[model samples]
Target: MAKRRLIKALAALLAVLAVIGIARAGGLYLNHTASYPRGLWQKSGDYDPTHAGEHPYVLACAPGKSVRREFIERGYLPWGFDCDGVEALLKRIWAVAGDRWTVTDAGIEVNGQLVPNTQPLTEDSAGRSMPVQTGGIVPVGHVLLLSDYHPRSFDGRYFGTTPIKDLISEVTPLWTESP
Candidate 1:
């Protein structure tokens, strides 16, 4: 019995290591945050990372240093995602460049359609005041990102549109649990 248990543990460890290795080599990611579903996501084919608006969801660097700090300190972003000294943020491209975006009491509106789960909060869960974006046309090279799946997600509603250059990669869900 003891020998069997030891073999099982070793097998489990090897399986985990193999999964991680395959994920790294194949540009796959595991979503652990509630902002999206918790599961596996694979990066789309290599393309122009400069076209942030073209993708539905992207892995990006936090909009600014202060924003990154806030997310890290607040426990919103994971420390494990440190890439090139910057933390990664997953965002859904709500509005592409040239789309008119507005912030209202109800929620964020894209071209006059109110996007659900985007009502910017005045204060975070810890009572810290959150940044509220001013409404405007999405500037060139910028895309408005949001988390419609999670209301409290610290996303573009707080920081407005992000530059296309911030996009690290486009990804698609392979398997995920409902959020």
Candidate 2:
């Protein structure tokens, strides 16, 4: 009986060590303040994690030109923009170059209909005034980003548009239970 108990304790210790290692290696603990959402997992075996905007996923800043103010369908890591020196974000790509876009007080309209959760915010949570973005034609090499899940998402409605040249790469969920 003593031997069995010792074995159980050793097993629990190993499990705890394994979990700690995974969290540290994956940088899960640092993700929150870092600005980038860590993907829980991939939805399926067939899904490729490297493809950009294939599905909802995380994004990491690649080494290149630092982006200025801009948000897309996917959330932007504060690091995506060099402003304020925040961390990176995760968002989706809604409209790419060649896609006609119009910005208004109500929200952003692609072609004609309004985008969900795009109603402009009068001010941020901190009560700072939010700037209104003027919409017209989407310029070449620019992509519109947004998130329908969150109405106040700091996306195209706020930042205007993202330059394609600034994109790093699309990240697939590390693991996902749902399809």
Candidate 3:
């Protein structure tokens, strides 16, 4: 009877361990390779990252969007490919630039030269042209994020610059081959 009880207890412990391992692996997989929209880019005007129920300011790629393929190939999932992705990339750039960059009313300036407004010069839905202002200095640990598709994207110009801390993580591909 004692032997049987010991065996059962050991089996239960093993089972728990297996479950935990699977959960952690699954979470890592989702973070790096999942292509589905996790509510990063919400069209709702009231979106707020600080609020529990509100969506974050980060941008994520649309489902089945071809742009995601490039990111996946580069070992990055479209984590915050929308607004957040831009922020992360900008942060990386800032990290590389170190003390040579500055944000201003005209836009980002590198060594006093305005960082060309890469975002397309266009108008919003209300017939008002989107503001070209990149705003403020690129302080240490801060980045000026923008969209890959500037003409059609609502990025830093729409939601403002994001701090490095706000960036969750760099997107990573789940598998080497197509799923």
Best by lDDT: 1
Local distance difference test, per candidate? 0.79, 0.54, 0.40
Candidate 3: where is the Cα deviation over 4 Å? 1-117, 120-122, 134-136, 173-179
Instruction: Give the Å shift of residue 99 in candidate 2.
Output: 1.6
**Once model 2 is optimally superposed onto the true structure by TM-score, how far is the C-alpha of residue 79 displaced, in angstroms?**
6.5
**lDDT value, residue 59 of candidate 3:** 26
Off by over 4 Å in 2: 1-85, 176-179
The TM-score values for the models, in the order shown, are 0.80, 0.56, 0.35
By summed lDDT, the worst window of 10 consecutive residues in model 3 runs over 88-97
**How do the residues 1-179 of candidate 3 rate in per-residue lDDT, one tens digit apiece?**
99999999999999977875675455332222222222222122321333311212332332233433543443334344344342223211211213344446555455565534434444655566554444455465444455332234434444444555555444333333332
lDDT tens digits by residue: candidate 2, 17-131: 7985686455432333322243353222221323433424433232223333333212343442222454444556666556677777777787686777677887876676765
Residue 13, candidate 1: C-alpha displacement in angstroms = 9.0
lDDT: the better of candidates 2 and 3 = 2
Which candidate do you rate higher for lDDT, 1 or 2? 1
For model 1, give the 10-residue run with minimal summed lDDT: 46-55
TM accuracy, model 1: 0.80
